[model samples]
Target chain A: MVSKELKVTTEAGIHARPAAAVVETCSRFQSRISFIKGDIRANAKSIMNIMLLAAEYGADILVEAEGPDEAEALGAVERLFAEKFRQE
Target chain B: MDGSSPRKVLRGIPVSSGIAIGPAYLFHPQKREISRHPVAPENVEQEVARLKRALERARKDIQGIRDRIAGAVGEYEARIFDSHVLILRDEEIMGTIYSDIRENLNNAEYAFYRRMNQISDRFDQAAGGFLKEHLIDLRDVASRVIDILTLSDGGKDAPEIHHPVVLLARTVTPSELAQFTTGNTLGICLETGGKTSHVAILARSLEIPAVSGIPWKELSLEPGQMVIVDGNAGQVILNPSLRDIKEHEGRRAAHWAHEQDLAGLRDIEPVTSDGKYISLAANVELPLEVESVLRHGADGVGLYRSEFLFLGREDMPSEEEQYQAYRHLAHHLAPRHVTIRTLDAGGDKPVPALQVDDERDPMGWRSIRVSLRNPAIFKVQLRAILRASAAGNVRLMFPMISNLQEFREAKRLTEQAREELRAQGLPFDENLEIGCMIEVPSAVLMAKEIAREADFFSIGTNDLAQFTLAVDRSNERVSDLYEPHSPAVLRQIQMVVEAARSQGIPVGVCGEMAADPYLALLFIGMGVDELSMSPGGLLEMKRMTRAISYEDARRSAREALRLGTATEIHQWLEDKFRDLFVRLGLRRGTGAG
Candidate 1:
């Protein structure tokens, strides 16, 4: 398993579009990806699960991936978080 | 709780005015007529394959809606569809649904529905805000898949509406609403929307009773159940009781009688009792509205919104196509003045053919700014207006002119179009009067400069209020802040009136404010030359104009100017006009009445 802690930098953190982008990116790999925000842990590939986390701006979330491509999946998710989900 | 018994009532924003009681037609565009059946044990693989194919079809459907919404609105609004596509493709949902169908020996439809319900319940149990809203996206994707899986014959064509119905929907596009009008659509109730939305405007124009902003999903509504839509009061009653029907019927009859009373004043001139004549005109959008303008005994067609020709179309209207539309109105309302506004596109009414990418401030890259930048399009419209002028008494007007420079530029383009027509020896009205719409705060301050180059002035108080107060009128959050009766907004109208008077030109008001009886009297009192509104408002405004003395209106206007806030102004006007309104049998909060 590969894990990395990242902060939501977008003004509207984990909004519909960002959450959607996160799910789209995480679902691409053959790995089980999860996002942990404090006590709430959500499957990164499920939009509803990610959105339920309600991770606001400047909040930290720990991204973990487990499978054959765990390392690749974690790297991609970290890059997406750093890019703020590419929202305008 | 009984199927045949009366249900609860819902409240919403009263967008259009009327009263309608009819059967409820739950209009779910993505709703499917699917049935559940236990699958044979041997055909389990077939059902799973069916589910996979349906998912693929659902994903394609979402992509189509995404592309269409992107084309019509923009990329930002279209992003919501991206999430819907992902939900359809989600392995967690697909894997669970497929397994349920195989193991439980259930039909694909039941499997998919059960899984969707489970996921949506999770969404509902989660924190509100973003998570709660995701339920809609989830349902949207599920519905698409269900629709594809259960695709059957004869389930199409506007839901088999056999009787007149109060159509209920989450949200309706203008084109969808247009389809329902062909049927026996009695009224419209939306789960979401504001008064300024396109659907709402179309409803008002069609004279349909409409109530928006209802949480319709929370309500349990069955197709063909009785429903009551009280647009004036913004109430929607599901499965209305007999008593409710009787009560609404009584109110409807009373409202009809009041309308008849107003219609009686249609023939009477809009001159105050003290003999100050106020020209009452109609603001027309579609050419079909010309009949209503004439029927209501309007003096002429004021503020002809030419944007209607360009809206909801794939390409820009050709010069000849526009000329024919304007000419039709001019000829029909011949001898009476037709102040046709130039292409007021780019704002809320964006022309797809123009390909204007700037959606930042739709109000910003709109109106005269759009025309001035794309002079070729502007000149085409101006030339059409000039050509239409040859058909009848057509006057040209420009909208959203913020300063003298924009007005001069618009006027210069008109002259260029005129010169082209003159050189071509095309018969056109050479002496057509030109006007400017004072709708911006800057225009109010520079009214004198703009009035110099213009032959007349028309204050569009809707945009004027929005610009003066820096409030987006369409935004429900700050819609109350967009007050036309506010002291600041009223003072601007007063300034424009004064500015026009100094230039020896006539001024009129062609906005929602002009249709308002209280503000109509105030504008008449403030020496406004004309007032233009919907045909429904013409006779009522005419009745009010004849009832009050010019001196009384002038005094009231003077008093209103001293008020500090919109609430104060509203209170004063209510105090002054409520008695008169009551006497006229105009019901409270009923714009139709």
Candidate 2:
């Protein structure tokens, strides 16, 4: 598993809508994805779970991915955070 | 209100749905596009001259916005244009275009276009379709430079106001809309916005009746077209005939006269001609709306839709932030009851983080369901409302409680909130009345059960009709099916009324349904103890109530319920109250008490 913390830059953070965007992109790869904020962990794919995180703008949360193409997933997720999780 | 001669008739989709008469100010006039054809040697000098001319024009246009922003709002909001100005002045980008390919001025622009198109590609990465359309923003700046050099503003002067004015535009900037003077502006019209844009808020702040989002795209727009924009109707008639102008003149006059009549009612009770005393509360969306609420004779605020605060904001408001806002609202309307509905995001209003497992079935999970799922967040809201309650007569309500189970569970959470406040020793009205909106069919059916435990029931007719009819109000195809006056909807409301009345519970309405002056008599007669509506609708409703005896309203309700369809009920009301229909035009909703 590759894991690291990245701060959310989007005005609304990695809430349900942005999380879905992230999930939609992540799901394309053969990788398992989950987001962790402190001890609270939730599936990146689940909108409800992501919103429950309440990751406001600039809230840093740990992103982790496992399975095949994990490196690719890690790179993509990092780039997304770098861009502030705003959907194109 | 000038240039009374009918100019040209124009048509577009009505978003605000109203009519008014005034001189037209056609903003965002169409521009003649310069072709992107390859330049031959003979025309190269002319092309270079055109490029220089456009640049000069764009600079002045940008400067006008800068000057206005510097004057009215502040520098911060205008910074978007400032960034655009920076793009125009980008040294490296401009230098690359002019220096890399050609020494000739016209050739320089050709090369610059190639360079900037690359930058445009980069700028479009925000992934906002709306922002992408802002490719036009670049064109606007560029073209403005062209206009200044070519003197376009001279021909496109702001239409002279012969009478008091109602300015119309397609999404006016904060700088443009704010500094409007009473000498010319009666109100304003923005061709794009829905209830929440900053321009809308500021217009309301100015207390001028402004409407937004009339499809200006399809209108026969001219510089000096005689126009009447019913900000309420979102209707604009260009060069309205003499008869149409006189007709709207009567409506506008009566409207202003009615304002004077309602000002007297502001402090007085909403007692009918008889001894029956009823509550006249205002349904508010934003705290800023409280002014209109007070202006239109609302004794108290019955329904404060807190969801508005969340609109256009980034995320859930922190408890402290919520507390400050609630405190401000409650304090401003001191001694007046401000019943705040907790965050009830449903339909198309879900927070990205906040989702409905089933968007199709609103009853699937939104409003109270979302609140129930997030207890801690809800506690923050409850605490804010409770804390704010101490400042004045304040209460909290929940939305979408279809059964006694959810109501009780919500109340349990409320008690939990109370306990937390007690632990903190926060000054709060512990016995504040907790109410639930009666929208879902199940909620109406279980009103008695819900009523026994809750303080009151506020009928949300908008959602009540949608849920009962199983229709999406937003879907134009099914919009006709979403009728508030149908027998099924009436029956559901009657059950709620019966439940409220049987138990002597106070019931109020805070939906577009209650704001309808045509339905004013019916709602009051249906045993609704309070009517909450847009402040603008207050006097008209009051007048409507005064015209019809309670006896007539009850009779209409009974007759209306027996009708098969809303259309039939509408026909029935029109046939009976044809004069009232004429006065109200059986038209112009989305404006309120």
Q: Which number leads on DockQ? A: 1
What's the lDDT for residue B99 in model 2?
Answer: 48
Query: How accurate locally is residue B213 in candidate 1, as Cα lDDT from 0 to 100?
Result: 91
Tens digits of per-residue lDDT for model 2 on B400-451?
Answer: 8878888888889888888988998888986788888999898887888888
Compute each candidate's TM-score over C-alphas.
0.73, 0.62
Residues B1-593 of candidate 1 have per-residue lDDT tens digits of 24865478888998887899987777753453334578899999988987888788778766886787788568987888888877777776678788888888888887888778777776667654546756666766787677676663112222345668788888775655755776488999998777766677668767788999999675586776788899888999888888999999998788777777777887788898999999999887777767778878899988888887887554578999999999999999999999999887765665655655325364666777878888888899998999999899999999998888888888888888888999998888878999999998999999998888899999998888888888887666887787777888899999999999999999999988887888887898888999987776677777777788999999999998898888898889988788887676554323435
Candidate 1 residues lying further than 4 Å off, grouped into runs, are: A1-88, B4-16, B27-128, B131-160, B169-176, B189-202, B211-221, B232-236, B264-277, B284-291, B304-396, B412-433, B466-488, B547-583, B586-593
Interface RMSD of each: 2.1, 15.1
Residue B533, candidate 1: C-alpha displacement in angstroms: 1.7
Reference-based lDDT, residue A31, model 2: 80
For model 1 the local lDDT of residue A46 reads 79
DockQ of 1: 0.48
